[model samples]
Target: MTDTNPIPARLAALKTMSGAELKKQWRALFDTEPPLFNRRYIETRLGYRIQELTHGGLKPETVRRLQDLGEQLDGGNIATRRIRTDLKPIIGTRLIREWQGTEHCVTVTRDGFEWQGRPYKSLSAIARTITGTRWNGWVFFGLKHHRRAA
Candidate 1:
């Protein structure tokens, strides 16, 4: 007997396909090599592709709305193309750190930082003011560190 539901049958078959076979299918479907060799990833993406081929994918308006939401979440602005979510401190957050023997506090602002009743453009400037030497403010405040060898 022949199967009627071709898409569902294809999706089911994807679960049992080998990595090389999945990569070949991925290249046919997406015109590119599969990003990884994981079985679950291949199955899930193939299922999605099968569904997309059977029924149309997301609407243009939905795509636009999603892009707009992503931009907003990334601190959307006309001037800045991209904003790093890791380094962006919410306004009114107080960052306290001990430098040398003294405790220094900085309040996060929309534009920059406020420290010791003075406004500074960058945390590194504040670090310089406090330490009297050049320092990475993110490292000084324990926000980031140098990468270690793998």
Candidate 2:
């Protein structure tokens, strides 16, 4: 189960947030929590955060970070659910759509990271696809509790 009190208050604060406040709030929320359980909780909350930002005009950098997080959560396990949920905010939103022109590297983005036929959402996703391993924060967008690879 989730924390009833903290989440509600946090959600309330998010409602009145501006673009500049978003990143800070997000960082604060994630920073306090230890690696409590799996990444599901973190991913879900982040998904909603993305949705909030979408209305404020999702910046390219934010989109890239979200996409990268999605990839990390997409190891085809329970984490995938969280990743998918996080992606919900951008489901219908327009992305830059990266193209790599190669058999691989087809990633989706919203900031024109497309090369060939790939549309990467974040750098981590790109690194994973290119390197073929679970990648954590590569670009360091200041996300809290990013689990380091063992």
Candidate 3:
């Protein structure tokens, strides 16, 4: 029996179409200026776009789940779902930690960190020197929690 699903044929035709034909198809499918990306990129994106248009795209719940995953990848934490990654704190911001009843302060700098008038490459290094043990820099400085609360 002949294949009744036309989507497979449409996708296959995308692979065989000439560059100019692909550009025309892209304009029709996307209704905007074709991106300056290479032909392969155009082909792959067009293929997906065509399928999405025909199949009506992802469900709302799936889209929300993807957005949540994207937020995590961009530095959202599990507990608060708002804590950003450690690499980005404003310059001159002070991070404080208490050890053995002594207050220690770390200042964010353009290049690295400044603690106790000395420059350090990472917060872990500062934490190790202060406590004499290995520690995750983010957790040590309270940017991240070492364990997720149950």
Instruction: Give the best candidate by lDDT.
Output: 3
- The candidate 3 region of ten consecutive residues with least summed lDDT is 76-85
Clash count for candidate 1 is: 0
Per residue, candidate 3 scores C-alpha lDDT tens digits across 1-150 of 887988889889998999889989998999988899898899899889988998889999999999888676644434334433355588799999999999999998865589999998678899999999999888999987788788
Error of 2 at 18 (Å): 31
Tens digits of per-residue lDDT for model 1 on 40-98? 86789888987997898999999999989877754566433443545668889999998
Model 1 weakest lDDT span, ten residues long: 77-86
Q: Rate the local accuracy (lDDT) of all candidates.
A: 0.82, 0.50, 0.84
User: Which stretches in model 3 have alpha-carbon errors above 4 Å?
Assistant: 76-150
* Predictions: Cα RMSD each: 6.1, 15.4, 14.1
Order of candidate numbers by lDDT, starting with the best: 3, 1, 2
Report RMSD for candidate 1. Answer: 6.1
TM-scores, in order shown? Answer: 0.49, 0.22, 0.49
Residue-pair clashes per candidate: 0, 21, 0
- The TM-score of predicted model 1 comes to 0.49
Q: How far in Å is the alpha carbon of 150 misplaced in model 3?
A: 61
